[model samples]
Target: MPDKDRSQRVSDAVHHRRWLILTILLFSLFVVVLDNSILNVALKTIAAPPPTGIGASQSELEWAINSYTLVFAGLLFTAGLVGDRVGRKGTLLCGMVVFGLGSLLSAFSGSPGQLIGFRTVMGLGGAFVMPATLAIIMNVFERAEQPKALGIWSGAVGLAIAVGPITGGLLLEHFWWGSVFLVNVPIVITAVIAMVLVVPDSRDPHPGRLDPLGVLLSMGGLVLLVYGIIKGGQLASFGSPLVWATMLGGLLVLGLFVRHELRVENPALDMRYFLDPRFSAAICAVGLAFFALMGVTFFMVFYLQSVLGHSPLQAGLLLLPLAAAQMFFSPRARLVVDRLGTRVVCGGGLFLVGLTFLGFLSLDTASDPWLLCLLFFCQGVAMAHVMPPATVCIMSNLPRSKAGSGAAVNNIFRQVGGAMGVAILGSLLSTSYRHGIEGHLRVVPRSQRDTAGESVTATLAVAQRLGPAGRALVQPAKDAFVHAMHVTAVGAGLAAFLGAAVVLAFLPGRGRGPCADDDRATPGSPPATGRDEPDL
Candidate 1:
């Protein structure tokens, strides 16, 4: 067979088997999304008896979550490019194996530090998994087929986020908290087996040579940037030199990394994609969407656990309303995006999420838990409308050749937003908590008041020492924390509204039609033009 003839045959094969390709792609995506949220519900379970030699406040509690996202966000672009250069199948298999190994390690961790180390390994695997899946979907499907496939992809993602917390909660109840990590082991092993059987090997036909320096610069820049977000609140003062250096240095490095890519013959990251407005807009929307999500997750969980004093299981159950809303409305979301346009659906969704947060201000720490579910349910409805459509628009608009990189870019911003959302929200919650605690403590006797003013970690310890009085003080401190969380909720909702403003202004309407570069996903086609980055 001649080379040209064989290429044509392969193209035909890809189009014919696109659905199978999409299934494989979404399953891998399921794993990546699942682990991100699964552990949040476990925060309390792990903190309860507290792992051997682990203290909730002193331990690397946040690090366990932050590390995975940090690594995932930082290395994602390089991984995408690597997949395009190497075989996507090989890249994916490598990622799965590492992910499985990390899950196994997390299950057996004897200390908080150790668990975090392994989670970082999982994040490394995530960097590979996320882009490869999206790239393959692009590689296999035609442009017209992308929205339907992406809708399905988004649905799987919705299911993952919805199921993760519930699954984690079940794991904690049936076994130890470690079981939460153990749950990934079987899922990963199964995915690996399926990959060997189902996934096709694909790569960039005219792949450029790898740029080692560009890779390092981009990855290092992301690492530093995320590191700053994770540690910013812990800094002695908001304007500390160390925090400034890391954050500033990270941005500088990323800027240099972009410049390096433009200069290099075969850049690991192709900066030219940014030149395309459609692609840029898509990436921007994804970032903002996740930013809203991360903020909600960060504050809502504490609102349930710290404010309302719900058990981990109880809190997990409350989220079911949000999950249910997504499940019920997902199909509708797809239809709306296809008919009304991506911007209208996404912008409207953000408005709802903002309203949910705004409405939460009506409650105090003593507010009814059932009413809180109404807010959670609104969030669910909001997410169901936005997520799938936004993903479809972004993935569809990007060129097929750069699909992996495009998805990776989107995922990276989402992770960064997730990290920052948590950091910023956490800081706000903590600051407000201190203020609320101080005001409440003033009404109590000196001996009783000091415990309320103590650090959250210290109060937990003093409760053990104080006997009945300590338990009495617990309610007061918790009340303070709850009031603080209420304030945080109002602020987070408003921030989401701000993110929506960006979408309303720049995002294109659906029925208006895709731009010229829209057909850019055509296989064996040249580069695309005129797409915006959907952003954070």
Candidate 2:
């Protein structure tokens, strides 16, 4: 057969397998994202002492989550660059292997410090996995189908959000705390095998040289920043000189990193991307949305388990409505955007999210479970609208060859925003709880006051040790936590509202669709006919 005929046949084969390829990519993405939320249900268990738990303090638990997020966010740009330089498929395979190993290590961790370290390793692998999946989708799907594909991809994240806690709950019910991490192994193995068999390899033919300094600066800046935030939370005050020093230093380094990127001939991340209003607004919206969502989620788990007296499995089950809304609406968000425009849809969604956050203000120790579920579902719907449209805007603006970079920007904002949410909102929760419960701790010994004031769990633990006397501390601790949650919710709600304002002001209106032609083009790109060719 002629070479032209053979090339046509290969193209047809690839075209037919695109959806299959997407399924495999989603599987890879699922496990990476699953780790982000799976720990929520287990945080209480992990905080327990001895063989049952790791005895991690609230600050340590925050670190456990943020450790993964910081590393993931910090390495994302470099990982995207790696995916573009090496094959995305290879990057994905290697990332999954590394993630699997990290998960295995994390399962057997004997201490909170060790768990934090192992989670960081998992983040490194996750950094590689996240961008590669989106980049691969960009290459596999045509522009017309990109929105649909992205919607499905976003929904996969929602699915992970749903599955993670429930899976963790189920495992924890029967198995040890390590079982949460251990569960990742089989999923990783299955995804790896499927990807090896079906996923096509793609890379930038003329990739830019690696920027080691930029990578170092980014990682250093993020770690310092997050550490400072966590430190402030641990101390329950931002007045510490150490907190200010680290935070300021981090900002300085990040500023310098931006300046360096602008001047460098071959930059790690092109600073010019922010010049696009759509891209910048969309990225910010995503960040802000996750900031609210993750922060609220961090506290809600505690509310369900500690305050409301629900089991881990019960808490996970309660979140079903939220996941259901996300899975149902994420894929259909594009349709809404097409009808109402990006600005309107995203802004409206964010406003709804803000409302949902404020809804938490109504909950107390005896609040109706149905009301809680309604709020979760509404928040999930809001998230569905926000993420897909914003993501589509960000990715569609970039050239397909730079999909890795585009994906990195999208995810970096998400992870960083989430990390900040956990750190900042968690600090607020801690500070508020301590203030409310401090005076009541007069009954407790001075030596135990600090630990008892640290968290609801600590206070309750102290109460439990006091036997019948401890019963008095329980109601006060619950009341203090509720107050703290309300305070955090107000902050998170304000953040969401601010995001709504930003997107409404800046994101593109309905005048042009997301996939409008830009200047960048592949050298030998085929013309887009606004439709996929029929499969062979």
lDDT of 1 by residue, 1-536 (tens): 34444343245555566677677667678877888778888875565555432444433677888889888889898888888777777888899888888988988887777888999999999889988887777666555556666666766776778678778777777787778778887888878887787667776666666678887898899999988887875442346677778999999999999888778877665566566555566566667667667776776776666657676677778778877787677656767776778778888988888888778777776778789788778888887777666676666655655667767887788788777777776777777777766754544457755544544544545664667656765776776766776777777777778767766776778766653354554323465432212110
Estimate the lDDT of model 1. Answer: 0.72
Off by over 4 Å in 2: 1-10, 515-536
Best candidate (score: TM-score): 2
TM-score to native of every candidate shown: 0.88, 0.93
What is the per-residue lDDT of model 2 for residues 1-536, given as tens digits with 9 covering 90 to 100? 24444333235566688899999888889988888788889888998898899899877887888788777887887888778777788888999999999999999999999999999999889989999999888777765567788888988898788778888899999999999999889989999998888888877655568788987887788778767766766676778999889888889998998999888877777788787777889999999998888888888988998899988888888888888898899989989888989999999999999999999999999888899889989988998898888888888777666778779889988887887787788889999999999989987889999999988988998999988877889999999999999999999999999999999998878876553354233223332322212212
Note the Cα lDDT for every prediction shown: 0.72, 0.84
Instruction: Identify the runs in model 1 with alpha carbons over 4 angstroms from their true place.
Output: 1-17, 48-59, 235-237, 439-461, 521-536
